[model samples]
Target chain A: MKKPIIITAALCLTGVILMGVLSGKDVEPGIVAKLKAKYSVKHAPSADHAGFEALKKKFTSPRQVTEACISCHNKRHKEVMRSSHWNWEREEYVEGRGVVYLGKKNAINNFCVSTPGNEGSCAKCHIGYGLDARGKGYTDQNNVDCLICHDNSETYAKAPDKAGAPEAALDLNAIAQSVGRPKRTNCGVCHFFGGGGNNVKHGDLEKALFEPDRDLDVHMASSGSNLQCVDCHTTKEHNISGKIYSLASMNQERSSCEQCHTAAPHGDSVLNEHTLKVACQTCHIPSYAKANATKMSWDWSTAGKLKDGKPYIEEDSMGNHAYMSIKGSFVWQKNVKPDYVWFNGTASHYLRGDKIEDTEKPLVLNPLHGSYADEDSKIIPVKIHTGNQPYDPVNKILIQPKLFSEKKGEGAYWKDFNWEAASRAGMKAAGLPFSGKVGFIKTAMYWPLNHMVAPKEASVKCGECHARSGGRLAGLNDFYMPGRDYSAAVEFVGKWLLLLSLFGVLAHGAGRILSARKHRNGENK
Target chain B: MKNIKEVLIYSGFERFWHWAQAGLILFLAFTGFEIHGAYSFLGFGDAVRYHNIAAYLLIVLIAFAIFWHLTTGEWRQYIPTTKNIAAQLEYYVFGIFRNAPHPTKKTALCKLNPLQKLTYFSLKVFLLPATLASGLLYMFYRYPEGGTTGSLTIETLRTTAVIHTACAFALAAFLITHLYLITTGKTVTANLKAMLTGFEDLEGTECEPEAEK
Candidate 1:
């Protein structure tokens, strides 16, 4: 009896809510599961292909779409022409792909530099909407023309709206034939698909959409919130004419993030007096959006093996891109110095200096969390030695990260029994030894050195950052001492080095002087 | 008093060794700071060169001083004692300001107060010994298994740097403490005078022969 009464009460409440919604009132959601169901397409665009055949059905060529796009967006077309995108397919005369059509013999693309025509179409992703796909017909018709997008086939006609070829939206009978896939699905078509032509850029296109506990595998399309193209795209800025800057517009900064995120994106205290400069992209990786990037790894011990007996790639339940991060670990042993570290991989679209060019020779990058780890199954050790910070790994020298930052330099070499033993003997033989804390004396930055800021992006480039041999982004500043210099053990090293050099120089100099005098005496005799 | 001058303020070799060792130690410190890239002195590279020379000179001077001290029985001056050691420490720390009488009086036969004995002894036995040994170890430091270390490990030579630095600061702190103690003498110039003239006048009559303590 109680159950029936409660059911009735719930039904009545739902009715009121439904009535309010019908009358245009905002409805508040309750923590209720009203038999929610999920839907998936039985089949999908190729993991190998981006369903470009559907695009081919709509437009004659990518060039036609470009032309239509230019017609609608005159101003944007001019800007696009100047952008890195326009330079994507470099054109020249007398090539087979050129208007005159020479054979496949003379194309100048990076992949097949001497091939013609289709080579332009093939390597189309080298620039521009290329960030979306190698050539997602962002070029073909030369107009922003696609049957799947904007229902262009309905409004702009196959043969210019003749009486016989009426648009499907207008004809009830043809509506069934023309009604196509939704807008969100079309957006994913490019967002998920990797690039093609010579270099396979972007990444694989057909990844599962809902990867719970794992990092998202989408590009400019990532967010904790499920967003439509217009949510971030906000206004249709008229600079692009009737074309309306949307997916095809490449140069626009995504001001949409500022609408919600309020965090100042940089390391704390990133300013000197009188400077209002900063960048958001310096630290935030595009696809790897989780707070910590280590979420995407797995315990290989339990994972099953592949046919080649290699472990099968398991999806990361956490956001860590173990595939990328493992390849980025740097260990400077006796000789290891890498040129660069690429924090992301084919999936990371906006991280500029991910490719840490030439730092690690025979650069080994495999697909774990996008880091530098060894092949097969070997562990590597990385010592996080801040160039100025010190620690004692032995005796009473507690080497915690906090110790280096705390005290001035007290525990730096306090437990280095070897150093203690060595310095003790020296002091016994000489005068006295002192002990104290050591700390960073005065550290400043050469702003344009290791980092750069352009409002939205920070370019932390290699070679550009680390610079020449022995030079550094964060150069050795002064040191603060609270105890013995060796308490921090940082200051004593140089004097010893100097003393050693002096002894060698003096020893040789004295020997030479004595030998010269002996020679003179022998001659006199 | 007439024969006091003939006892020799300090033996000729002892005086020479003291001045030379002090000069070399000071030179080592001056050049050490410049070499540490703290501030430019003789330029960075040259500072390193000079610091090395000074450090080696100190080592040699110290070597000679040790032999002299042992042979002439001067090493006994540094032998430590616990009698009145606590009182001597208190005299230097708190009593010195109050003008309280010293707990352990100094004399030609027993020059070091108990506190001074402990401190100076530690400098020699622990601090100074550690520094010298570390210096020698650092100078001779090289991988017995020669050839460049593989690219993934830190150089053993770098360890020397850390050890040497540890001792340098220890020595520096001692110098600062020593300077402060020097000022604690009866007059600002009194301790300096004793080392220079080897005579301390008493606050009592001329028969006492000490006008400063």
Candidate 2:
């Protein structure tokens, strides 16, 4: 009794000690301190600097404001002219296809089609003044719209089709006077509203980032790290790092978690080993569109359906647009789990004049290229935005349809509600042939999910990827995972061995018991 | 009744704890296999829910059993001994069919044979703890703050799952052998009746005092 009591007390004490050790405070603040030291720049020239005082003069056009600003910061416009954001064109060598010129300029995407004829609506996100390269030459010094990014007043609003000029009554002098470092609100003005509305293009980026709490994004959390967009996407001479796979040019520096944290950030060595095959975003960003619903799928075939001879709009259960007569039927989802894919940072786009070989499968407008065999490839999360768009039946190529118009009778699909006229005009403007035979073809575009990182405590659980069925990585047979992947032959042999052993034990025990019983009975007799 | 004697082999608390643990183990196995997608009688979600509840109940039962064993000094019964273990093995293998006598005698102070002591001790000390620890880790993998447990990657989670499953298989094997051994008592119903009534039929002679030591 005394021994048992002592042993029980020892066991309880051991458990208490183990708990205390495991709950000890962390000692490594080295990485966070290093990141803060390296990139934290002085809040870009405060408003009282002489550069802002010179901007107190009257300004009419955005170009006039740029000319005055360049008088003091002369090299700013030259730096802006070299970026892809200024030219709207990118050239890169894809694996199967030789060197190809691809960008929003000529590449056909599922959303908003090509930018050739739709530059007025698309160029609203462009940093420079004018629509595409038509209004101002690439070398034009006055075309650099500095206030678009530097405006702290947040009142500078650019109207579509006005040659990158703000609204009629807006105070350009106030915007010029308040120019300073850009904030999350500054970059989000155009990026968050991409693809015609909020949470449309990149499911991970939206208006919620403006004042996000820690749950939505730990880095951009108002009460946490509170990092700005440019913190990780560092810039040199107006050239920003971390271009998307669809827009990246050759020899560009890609932004990664290694910029702030070491490659092996986890304390556990086994977990650190997975960094080679898994992207940080795959685990960090558990889901996208946490703050709002994003468009998942669109069926353009359902568009142009009018109610009582007028365009109509219908809302789904979540109050997201289910159908719009001008656009199409859309399926919206919130807190969406991302699809996993292998990416090697290189992407191939289906540019205009590219042939459609397989009409049976949805046309891949922009396909990220990678495989498990590639050392450069890692399992990354992506959001697949699927839709149907107009294509030429006889020409066997996708046709861009003009969707928006400043006025009626301009062959815009929304105004005329005619696919044929819109296709002909859009194709003519894009310098592509139209066969007068139009049909809707299924198409898909992949958008990489790299934002809306949840706090580290909400990462995916073990069974989510390791279970035999209904696991996240169930069908990914390229790489071997222990619990998830097993050999049937090995299992069969193991089962047989267990069965044989059990049989031997049963037979031997039965023989011993029976013979003993017989001998005892004989002795008694 | 017929030159037979009955002795108190298992206490009432011991019998109750044994049966409760056995029932809980069976339920856990059923639900665990369903969650593993072996047969899927219950849907994945429902199987997970049932498995978690059964696991919690088993944990509570184990805690109570440990307390009872410590306070009553019954924990000493499972301390392993090599004495007569070879003889016990020989009896199972060859001597039993010849009507040879049992190598070791049972008493209230020494309730388990040498082989039972070792197997039960290992199950209690190693296999059961492994299963429970891995299971709890998997249950609370994600923290309330936002991410998973500190430094726990998906690979760590996968490794934990493998450990839990391997321990479960070991437990199943042990249970099967235990069930078969129960029928090998002096009479087929002797062991079952003892577990149910706390009294077991034994040979006419009293147990040796040295056997308890």
TM-score of each candidate? 0.31, 0.72
The parts of candidate 2 lying over 4 Å away from their true place are A1-29, A33-53, A132-137, A249-252, A503-525, B1-95, B100-213
Error (Å) of candidate 2 at residue A202 is: 0.7
Q: For each model, chain A TM-score?
A: 0.27, 0.92
For residues B1-213, what per-residue lDDT tens digits would candidate 1 score against the true structure?
333321223555655565555555666777665555455546543444455455566677688888998998878878887767788777655565455666754555566677787888898889888877766665444322112232222234345556666677767766655655665565657665665545564432122234224
Put down candidate 1 lDDT per residue, A173-217, tens digits, no spaces.
222223333344433333333221100111121233322122432
Model 1 chain A: lowest-lDDT 10 consecutive positions = A443-452
Task: Estimate, for each residue in A1-525, the C-alpha lDDT of model 2 and write its tens digit.
Answer: 224434544554354335434533222357667765654544646345435656777777788888888998998888888777777776688778789777777777777777766677777777776664354545678878788888889898887766555667778887788777778888898889877789988998899999999999988888777898988888899887887765653435788876777666664333455567778888788899999999888888889999888899999998988999998999999999999888888877787988899887898877887777776778888899998988998889999887767877888888889999999889988889999998989999889889998887887654566577677766566765543554454445545655765886688676766776777788899
Give the candidate number with the greatest TM-score.
Answer: 2
Q: How close is candidate 2 to the true structure, as a TM-score?
A: 0.72
**Once model 1 is optimally superposed onto the true structure by TM-score, how far is the C-alpha of residue A233 displaced, in angstroms?**
57
